[model samples]
Target: MAARYLVSPRGGRRAYPDITSALRAAEARGRAALIEIAPGHYEEALTVRGEIRLAAAEGPGSVLVSRPRGAVLDAFGAVSVHGLTLAGRDAAVDIVGCHTGTLTLDRTEIRAHDGVAVHGRPHTSVTLRDSVVLYGRTVFTGSAGLIERCRFTDAANNAIAAIEGARVTVRGSRIEGSRIHGLRVCDAQAEIVGCEVTGTGQAAVVADTRGELAVTECAISATHAEGILFIEQSRGSVDRTTVTDALHGIVTKSGAGPVVRGSVFADCRDTGINVQDAGLGTFENCRVTHARNVAVFSTKGGAPEVRDCLVSGGNVGIAVTEGGRGRFARIGVEDLAGTALRVYDEASAAFEDVRVERCPAGLEARGNGGTTAEVTGAVFRDISLGAVAIDGQSRVTLRNVTAERGVMGFAVSGEAMLQVTDSEVAGVSGGGFAALGSGRLVARNITVTGSEGLGAFGTGSAYVDITDGTFTDCAVAASFDEKAAGRLVDCVVNGTSGVAVRHNGLVDLVSLRTSLPVVRHKEKPAAPPQIVQVLNNPVFNGPVFNGPVHDVQLAWNNGHVVQQQTEGDGTHP
Candidate 1:
């Protein structure tokens, strides 16, 4: 059986004068004891060392236990506090486990003016339910605990901190107005579910230095810095969470690899998700919108795998720079003012099934050295500038790509190398494909239609090779100029208004079929037989071989016509 004791500030028959006297009497009884305190203010510190329960005679806010300094209640045994207000200048409640001690607080209010509200030491356990902690922090060091339906407001530091191997689970909590991080887990493990954390000074949640955290179904907003930060080799997962109005939504650095799934990040100032400094992360089924800078950025040797993600309304959609590498699949980028995807500065990326629409530029690869991008099954539509641009010693390969309704289709410049296979460019206002400034282009099985300018153009010492290509409805079908050199094998030009094939530089045409004539410019003389071979070409109008046509064998109505004009005349032969 349990013994019950009553305490009152005013003396009465069979009632103790103070709570200390009643506690002492209950301790001497040596059984489970309950000490009921009357509705009065007790200005004394208390320590519980036995199995005891402290309750208020009235309801909550009726009994006030206040201490000027130090902890108001120090519990070392199995202790329970119900419906009482504990206030202290240093700490409101301190639990130090002697032999796996436990403290339970139900429907209580704790106030700490300058220190922590609840502090649990090693090997202790705490269960706090329906409680409100104000003006302080709750810290667990090497302890395990559960906090349910609690409100921690106006915390001086982090509202909840678990460090030094502490394991904590917080459910149905509202942590608001923290001066520092809302929840911090360092070298510990924490699970946060169904919580709302708002107005944090720093990151809403942080896991650092081997700490593990799992956040699910939470709404974290209005953070000054990153909404969730994982650094120093920490690992975690965030599922089905929404983070909004932060400097950055999620940041992973220093070898941290966190798996984020089914999340939405919106209205961020900087990048929505940043993976840097050798960090690794997997983001799947995520949506990022209205970011000021890039939606997703991977840099400094970080390699992130992004799949089935949508990025909209950012300055740049995704950037892999500064030795970073990424693999992206099934990505959609739309409604941006700048380039949709950019890879540069010794970075490399592989993209599959990527679609970019309503952007200034689609995909850009520029670097000083050692940058590479491989794209397969990509589509670029409704673009203002070039759909794909490759520059500065970078190497890019595109297969099964389609560009429609763009200014230009593909532009390769500045010593770059581009290999395009099985591609189509349609409805472009400018040139379909261009290789300029000592660049190299190798295209196979390409089709160009409805281009207002030249279909295929090479200039400025560029080298172009096209095999089995078709150009239709272009002003000029193919033009090679300014010391450029290339070979066109088995190519056809149809419905061209201007000259079908105009050669101002070195070119070899083999088995070419054109509707209009082939014109060699008078500024540059034709090369020798091997360099300028017009072999087996069927022309509607006879070619105007202006200057020194060597090895020129034009077939007209299945008959060979070999003519040489060295005087640069406008005569057709």
Candidate 2:
């Protein structure tokens, strides 16, 4: 067995001259040894071949180890170093190759000029506690490492990088001012907790390549790229974190699945949360704000779910496109310059209990073929162009929705289908509800009031079916073009305007009542060949029949009605 030795500049009978000589004598003994260095400066590189304990006699500042040529300490076997400061022109420490036991560093400080501070090789297990690495990066390849209570600063590249089967854990660490990612894990696994990472040129934390990374209780900000990036089939969990001032706060890319909870992402230059390329993201109790683009974006075949989230101050609050699918619940969006929620191009989504206010377009869905959306208990107020717009062969259903102060409250066009029930559209500058260009609408229990234009307008071969609704205070309550068709069943149209219902198209009126005169027949250049009838109904505020008079029972109808037009050129019945 080798005997422990102490090294000091003041030579004594039992003390060695330097750490190099002590290490030599210890290795020759063929056993474990402890070399205690006294307070002094040593300018030499020491490489260990066996188990050894090298420590400062007092504390970290008591002894200084500097090697101008190479690494200060290169350990091939089990080694423990404590309470020392190592400054190297090259690497400060390297733990390499087939460690039969554990390697540990405690209360140490390392300063590297050109090379990395700490490098771990394959088949090594290393641990660092209460350490500081300055001006260099740390790389762990195929090694299992643990880092705790450490501070890393001013790295030219990634502060900590784990690659190729490395398993690393970092806790209670502060990493700052890195040129690239603060912590990067590729083809490896990592767990980071209670860490603060800031001022990175790239993503603050990157997890890629089938790796599992868990980050909790962390603060990441001021990153040029995403604050947290999960890509290339990586799986991760991020919780209780605050990320701000990044291009994107959190991004899931290319088949990644990440669950984020209890987080706040604010003031991002781009989207606050972005999921793309078939990535699946789940966010709960998250708040995102002040994004320049879409606040939460799921596109390029991604699917995301957001619950209890608040998104505000963006061009679009949430956008799902390019075959994306999402579900949002209890979402509140306000003050958007563009559409609050947009689903387009074969995308589909469901929104419940959503509230949108002060947006140019509240909810818009446009698609070429296979887009669909369902919204329940949604309220939109103070919009510009329109509150809800559905177009391009898409379909949307809105229930218990309320819209106020918009141009066209609900606009449907281009063969789209919209069903609105238990909804209200009020204070609209244009038509309260419009169906244009082969669009279809099926509405029940809907109310429209205070529209400057017609309350309901259907044109260009559009179809509208009102099951039970009311329209008031508009130029014309219901107006349909010649090519359009609709039916009003158990509905009421009342307005201060002289005309309540005007239709050049075919409108089936069943139990329909109006407070203003109904224009049964429009005055065309010539009376149409078809015979029109004027009903003698008392529910109308004005005359029910205006065109012509026919047989008494034929003039009015529920079961039987007469068809006659006083203007000539049409046959009377």
Candidate 3:
């Protein structure tokens, strides 16, 4: 029953006036053909080889197949184009050579004034269901396609392009207003499901070079650039995608590697997941909101692997600069205006179970001296400033960390190097672990509670070494000013309302136990011996222990007056 042919410009006698004489009287009645086209304009420029079924008896813009120049349906093999309205200048549905059947364009209405508006080659097999491709660009070189529910509008270029070894599958498509890139895959292999790319001038899904993309549940919006763009050595996988108001949301650079899962980058103006240069990615369960800048930006030598993420209101949430390196697990950065995880130049990062809340600053490792940050089980809450801020010549390490209600909690300055173990600094207003300038702090079993100020601070030529420490209710529980140097072993300064150990400089107290009033020697006469070297058994009594002692030690077990002096000629013992 494949042999009906009736095309009319009213040339009667069983009607076959145009449509290339009704496809040459159905190819001399030698195979499959059904060319029923009756109503209106047909400027003729068709070359269908063999099995054809070109319908449009009166539906769909009432048949208008205009040519004016090259390609107006030049399909080979089994072609089926229903409800026609194909107009062209060059390529308005041109499925070239060596076609292995199938070139169906159901409910068609493709119109190109310049170039491509559906041009498939390389053993072509294209099927665009519920079609409506307008104004140029819809190329598929090594074709093998299926674009269902299609409607690519106002595209002068790239509103669907699958290069070289193309094998495309775009389902539920609706790409609108694309001047450039609303779906482009270079060394082709694409699978975009439930797509809805809107208002794109550039990059609303582009996988360059060795392209291979799979964007599922897609809904990319208003992209001027980058809403899923994997450059050069592209690799893919972006599931559950939803990128809104994008400038940059999902951009994996040069040596691209993508594995973005459960994505949702909202209100992005810049960087919501940009892994640069030697890019490599693995972002799982992502959700970056209000990204005005850096919600997840790994620069130059980017190495990303962010897991279980949720970054909110960004100015900077996850920024691994220049020589970037990342491995952030279980992240949750909230309400950031700035600095909530930024590892500067010569970068290196590794954070686990991270949580930074109400940020003004939390986790800022500065550059130059090769920055490095390693945090485990991190939690910095309501940080208004300094909740782990290590400066240049950086090297930071915190294990099982928690800095709560911070104004300052772990702020190590230049020539930096900090190592905090089993950390905890609660209710800080200022100084709950601060080592300035020539910074170097190594803490273990740390716990500084309710600090209104000073619960472990070292000034200028800073150097603090705290072991088995705990300073509770601190206003001043541990401070070493100006040419600073410190070492508090097995320390415990409990409920200090003021001065528990505030030496103007140099301090080394082992097994020092205090409940307020330990030492406060701010009188640095020509500075250099504001020393407080108290050995082993220390349970110092009030009177603000005016310092200047070399090796003082006191002992008195049970009743606990255990203070012992070894060699103290200059004062206070």
Candidate 4:
């Protein structure tokens, strides 16, 4: 085995005073000398060969290499560069075609011009550790290399491109201030961890893969497109990550879906997660909030498993259309402008322990959609309009859902059938349940409570079987209006005027149960509670919030989101 060579800029009294002369002398020495560069501006393009160890004192200010006209450094054979600066260059630091060798850089700085960077392809191992690649434009390619703990800034185009069959691993780094994508992985398997990518025109990480790609402990923000995107046969996963201030928080291109877990998506213009085509994955233990369009979009294609997620502040929480399905488990969706979990267009959905709250219309099904939309053990509270609206002949099965404070708790319009069993509806604004058009309602063991407006209003509905239910504290607990008959069996109506019928209507009352809110007169009401909890994460805070202020979700979420809080042991759930 051959020994390592060195190239220094300084020399002894008998030798030269700069690195070029020292390198020439070391070449005369046949090999094996450690080249340590001092703090000086090297204004020349350097070319190195053989097995060499290249180093510098500290960062770019210490040993700066400035070649503005062209490339600064070129190397061959097995080489390692540490703490060197290739600055003021208008071209690439070409590594050429190194064969059967390892090229490594530690704490080096590369500031190149448009369409330039270290292009070493189809060769040996290349690594950059704790480096910086800044102020580069990419008409050709800015970066196609393996890097870690790096920072890329002020990119005019695509910052980094992982070519076909490239193994690019970017960890504990940042990609920001880009005119285009921060990281573009094309036909490669990528693994990115603990990184922050922001300020892009398109996307943060566009991983075009043939297989698996993983991004863990990262933050993606302020992109026009999705924050994390996977295209073509690529499977993606994100754990303990955050995406904010994006047009779409996450998107999977055609034929790809990612397993997203332990993440947060906030303030997206479109959906939190958009699946464009066909694939299958899972999203567990995530939070999607402040979405303007839809929270979770399984619309175009690709059915994914969603579980243990909290979704709030959106138009539609989960919209499954265009032949997509979902296995939803333990999810809570609230405060929507439109419906919550709208499944239509031949999309099948299943909900297990899901909560939909505070929406205008919740759980709407239209256009022959959702064959297996079975709701089990869920809660719907503080709804404004319709808790569960059905249209276009959708078949839905409900089990043990509590709907409180809504205009119409259940409205099965458009000739739809609803098989509801063991549910409670309380404090509804308009009515407890309403069924319009010809449909079948097989309701068993239901409780309607607190002032139902024409408690059970139906028209053109089929024979209703109201078996084993209770009604409490409501005036006109049961009523039928236009095109239905009344079937009163073993039913109980407490504190209500008797059932009313109007205009060829139908009434079916089996049983009912009601309860009132406990009245408590307090001496003083507590002060209005703060809505947001102050974040205490100190990582990447950059002198602890001394940097520029970014978004409003960190500031005005009830005033405590941006404020610094005392150190309380924050264990994330």
Which candidate leads in TM-score? 1
Candidate 3: the clashing residue pairs are 553-563, 553-564, 553-565, 554-562, 554-563, 554-564, 555-563
Ten residues in a row with the worst lDDT in model 2? 91-100
Model 2 compared with the native: what TM-score? 0.85
- Which of the two candidates, 2 or 3, achieves a greater TM-score against the reference? 2
True-vs-predicted CA distance for residue 217, candidate 1, Å: 0.6
Q: lDDT for every model? A: 0.87, 0.86, 0.85, 0.71
Residues 1-573 of candidate 1: C-alpha lDDT, one tens digit per residue: 668888898878788888788877877777888888899999877777688888998988899998887668878678888989988876434421223488888888888776678877789998889998887888889998799999989888899999999999999999898889889999999989989988899999999999999989889999989899999899999999999999999999999999999999999999898999998899999999988999999999999999999999979999999999899999999999899999999999999999999999999999976999999999999999988999999999999999998889988999999999999899998888889998999999999998888888899999989998999988888889888889899999988377788887498998999878888866745563432334445652444466775564445444444545554466643
lDDT for each residue of candidate 3 in 1-573, tens digit (9 for 90 to 100): 798888989777688888987887777776999998889898887777789888988877798888777666677788888989888765434422225666888888888866677777886888889988886777778989888998988788888889999898999989988888888999999899988998889888889898999999989998888888898988989998899988998889888898989889998898889998988989999899989988899988989899998999969999998898989999999998999998998899999999999989999988877789899999999899888988889898999899998789997888889999989999988888888989899999999898998888888898999999888888887888878898899988888267778776478889888857877674624333333333444555422356555534433333444343333465644
TM-score for each candidate, following the candidate numbering:
0.88, 0.85, 0.44, 0.79
lDDT of 3 at 222: 89
Q: After TM-score superposition, what is the CA distance of residue 296 in candidate 1 from its true location, in Å?
A: 0.4
Model 2 lDDT vs. the true structure?
0.86
Ranked candidates (lDDT, high to low): 1, 2, 3, 4
lDDT of 4: 0.71
Could you list the CA RMSD of all candidates, in the order they appear?
10.0, 10.3, 15.5, 24.3
